[model samples]
Every structure is written in structure tokens, then in C-alpha cells.
Target: MTLGNRKKNAVKAATAAKVDALLVTHLPDVRYVSGFTGSNAALVLTGNRAVLFTDGRYTAQAKAEAAGTRVVIEKKPAVTAACEWIERAGIQRCGFDAAHTTVAALEAMRKAVTSKVRRSLFHPVGALVAALREVKDADEISRMRVAAALGCSLFDQMLSIIEPGMTEIAVAAELEHQARLAGAEGMSFDTIVASGERSALPHGHATTAKLPRQGFVTLDFGVILDGYCSDMTRTVHMGNALPGEHEAYDAVLEAQEAAVAVVAPGVTAGDVDEAARSVLRRAKLDRFFTHSTGHGVGLEIHEGPRLAAKQTQPLAEGMVITIEPGIYIPGRFGLRIEDMVLVTATGGEVLTPSPKAWIQL
Candidate 1:
């Protein structure tokens, strides 16, 4: 692939692994490693050269779409093309992505290549690619910031328009419509519009249930931009605020803020989760605040370095994660506040700058 620096990065990683070349077969890794978004393609990544092999179904489109990787149109099975390429290139000790290939495929590769050359399987070539993607450059971070801001604007757009008569599905649809109009490619996941008793469900998706005028209505949504992603959540009252709802909402906001405040390079993900959970425990609401504080997000909404009590990974500079805290009182109501954040040199930078105070919709 002739990508700006990705080809070079993949080549460098191959060299570091002491392999003559890397054969990428995973679809996502194929896209990430060589910018080949096609359904069928194998990327052969060498130090100074690369090749993209695909079936005849996409001969012309592969050539046009995958300009980064040199296209090789093959009418039959793809493994044959890979072996033939390896033999012609006189490559020795080539590496394949073990994560993507099956045992049968590995055997076929072994049988195809000459015994004089060695064949090895690497658990993940995508790992190297993912590690590279973890660091959000200024350009990437700015896109994410825009995504979050657009998501907030969409919330604003949908707020006044929504009334107690609408179903949760109706509210979610309008939120998505507003987000798309505000320049988001689409939501990273299904829009969550849980209200009243339904709010007790942690991942409660929008059902046909109509919203109640007083308890909690949790709105969780995210936007995508240029292959990057942003996530955010805000819970509000349907009409007038309830007495205890404000307290729970404030506690969730405080817990989320506490988690976000302590995020920095060298901090453990589990510690960040505890920072939020501790606040809920002090309020005797720890049992209600379930799920991880957050998770690393980028090309994929949920990536590595999970921010949960069960994880031990440390936060690193350039890593972007979310800080979300919630309290769910079963069959009653629930509230949550979430934001995307970047781990920086000093501490954390909250990319989603929207106000977290409970909205009276």
C-alpha cells in the first residue's frame, strides 16, 4: 500500500518482528493495513513493497478503490495467489495473521509454499495496527471533538421538539435525524432512549413504550466522523424534575467528573473506574452504578484498555476513552452522564464539552 505513512509503519512492524513479510487476511486489518475496504482482499506487506489480491468479482473496483495497495486480480482461491507471490518474491520465513486464519487454511498454506521456506503465524498483525491507531494525533482528536460537539447540538435540536406523548423510539429517531443533519456520518451504535421504569435496564434500547412525564429518560448516543468515533450520554426528566432524581443525576455527574479528572498517562484503568464508583459508594448507591466507568474508543467505539474494576491496563498518552457513570434503580428510574476524554501528559482532556447538568425536557 502507498498510504502516506501506514505502509511504512506496517513494513517497520514486520521488520521488528524479524519477518520477511506479512500476509494480511483479516477484513478489518486489510482495511486498516492497506486501505482496501473491499470484502475479499489479501494484503502482502513487504518492507518496501505491497500487493492487494482479490477475486475477479472486484477486479476493476479493487484497482480503483485500493490505490494504496497494488491490486492483483485472481479468479480462484486467494491463498494460491499469496503462496505464488511469496515464491516469486523468494521470501523466506513469512508471517501470517493467526487471528484471522483457521487451522485448515494454515495447512493449505504450508502445503502450497516450499519446505525450504518457513511459514509462521502471528496472533495479530492488527494489534500492531491498533496500537498505532491508539494515539490520537491532533487532526484525529479535532475530528472527535467536532463529533462530540455535533452530538450535543443534536441533543439540543431534539429536546424542545420531543413531548411526553412520544414513544422512546420516536425520541431516538429524532435524535439520529438531528445528528445526521449536524454533519455526523451516523451513530456509532443504536440510540438509547430509556425512560421511567425502562431506564432500569442498563443497555435499554428504545422500545415502543411511551415516555412518562416525570422520572428519568436516559439518552445515550454517539456520532462518527472520518472513520473516527465519539460517544456521549445524558439523562433527563420528561417534564418537571423529581425530588430524588436531581440528587441521583448530580451524583452520576460527579462520579463521571471524578473519573475524568484523574485520567492521565500512567494511571491504571481500574483506578479510574474506582474513582467514580467510590463517589457512588459514599452516597450508598454503589450497587446501582453498574458497568465500567469507560472504555478506549477510536476507529471502533470500544477498543483496548478497558476502564473497569476488572481491568489493570494503564492509561497512556494519546489514548482516548470515555468517562460514564450511572445509577439504575430497578422498576423506578435511572440516570447517567457520559463524555469522551483524551488521556494527556498532565491529566485528561474532556473532548465532549457539553453541559452535564440534568436537562428538563
Candidate 2:
């Protein structure tokens, strides 16, 4: 769906939620609704009307991107400008993102308003958008599929170039660069380049750690193309691998596949997670499992309807999420395999398009 349609959904949500107007101040949320990709912007959604506000820096962009929505250039903070509109429009309750806006910003906004309109720190309008975003339309699914194809091939490209002496940071930079070269808008998150003992950290930063001669190197990466994102993880051996390393990698991959096989609409997020964790548990590697099975992915890297224990949401058709199962052993090394999966009417569709087998390069 286009930004105009997203705005319409927001307006519909505002009316249902009893909100006079949703003052969305989160940059991603603003972009999601109005296509106004600015560092600072806010979206105001009335029942059937919407307006986008941004400062002078993005005045031109706002005008260009914010079609089917009203655009206003702000001279100061967006909340300040929103206050002006609320007073003039006689809005009694203006919704705000308490999760994104600071307490000081809210207080300042209250003081700025005419005391006629009530300022409420409602949960972000993005939360509503997030729920909507979970189920991808045909166009969104297509973008993610392209991202998946590029990401899958791009990974093989990076794997073919790994050398014994390359630093983790260098590999990460090269991976991102190639992703951009291969049509990736950007990376969804910091590309993980963990080697040797550093691999024990699930979300390890790309550091100066050089590739080990024969241990595990976990490369968790994602690609953003056409506004959608793709995620994949592959653990490889820098050289001929060791037995324990191979075994660990094998278990993780098997567990990931086990989960992937059972993903479908009408399943609970917890059930999907269990499908994988049970495999690890059977292998007696459950202790090393430090995180949830995976998470939802869409406009933002980590979206809603998480696949984890006690996740109260159900998997639905058109919902795209990740199936990353890992085993991290502190002080030694870690093994993880992640891939993007789109829940379909039939079953789950893999979006990463990468091979999960342990490859030695």
C-alpha cells in the first residue's frame, strides 16, 4: 500500500481509538504514514483527514513526498507546530507517542497549547501502523522478495571473498557496500561480524577481531530494498572446521529449519518458537539458547507480533518475520542461522533466499 493508504488507516484507527488526532512524532512512523522521510517530522491524523509537519530542512521534501496529505513547514519543533494546529482546530484530545517523545517535550507541548485541548501521551500511532504493517500487501511482499533474492545472492558473494586475515569491521563494511551495490537501500541493522570468542555475543559489533583460522564466524546481516527489509544469518568456518564447531552449527541450522517448517497462519508466535527450541532442547543445547526464536520484520527491522515465549499474538497471513535460532556459548563461540519468513495462506515463505548449510571458506 502507498503512504496515502497508510494515512487513511491511521485516520480510521484514530476514530476507533477515540483520538481527536494522532500526533505521531516518531521519524519512522511519520515516514510510514506520509512518506515524509525526514529526521524531524510529525503526522497528525484526524478521523478522515491528515497533515504532515516538518521544519525548513525538509520543507521541500515534505511538499514533494507528502501527496494526498496536507503539508506544513514548521519553524521550530514539530510538537510546537502541532500545538498551533490543535488550538486553532479546537481539538480536545491530541494523541502523542509517549514511547518516542520525551517527558520534557510533552510538558513543553502542554505549556504551548491553549489549555483548551487535552494532551494525552497515547501509545505511538506507529503501534497501530505496525499492526497494519505486519500483514504485507502484494507490493510490499514483492519488494521484500526482491530484497531476499539480492540478500541471498549478496551473501554468497561476500562468502566467496572471506580471507583468513580480514578484520571483522572490514568484512562488515564490505558486506554493506556490496549490499548497496546490489540494490540494497541500506542495512536494517548493524551487520554482525563476530569471529572467534566474540561470536559468543549474539549481537556483537564488528570489531578489530580477525577471522579465526578454524572457528565459527557468525555473519548476521539484513538488506533494505524498496523500503522493505530482509534478514539472514550464516555461521561459517574460516578454514577447515573443528568437530565441536561443526556440530554446534549443525544443531542450530537443524533447529532453524524445524521452526521454519511449521510456520503458518493461525499459529501462535510461542508455538512457532517452540518448534525450534524443542530441537535445541533435544540436542541438550537449550542452555546456550539466550534469546527468543525470532521477530517480525517490515518497515522497521524489528516489528510487532514477536515469535517468542509468551508472545500473545497469532501468526497471520502476509505477516513477515524472521526465524533466527542461535546457540551462543560464552567464552568460546556461538552458532546461529537466521532467515526472513513470510507467513502465507498456505505456509511460511522464506525471504532470505540463502543456503543455511555450514560453508567453509
> Which candidate wins on lDDT?
2
Per-residue accuracy of model 1 over 267-330 as CA lDDT, tens digit each = 8999999999999999889999878888878777887778899588888888899888898888
Error of 2 at 276 (Å): 0.9
Q: By TM-score, who's the top model here?
A: 2
* Per-residue accuracy of model 2 over 1-361 as CA lDDT, tens digit each: 8777788887787767777778877777777788877788777888766877778988788898888889888787787787777667767666666666787877877777765444443333435665677788888888888888887887888878888789999999999999888878899888998998899999998998888787888888888887778888888887786668787788888899999999999989999899999999999998999999998887788987788987768899999889999998888889889888999999998877677776887
Using alpha carbons, what is the TM-score of model 2?
0.94
**CA RMSD of each candidate after superposition:** 3.2, 2.0
CA lDDT scores, all candidates in order: 0.80, 0.82
| Model 1 steric clash pairs | none
Task: Compute each candidate's TM-score over C-alphas.
Answer: 0.86, 0.94
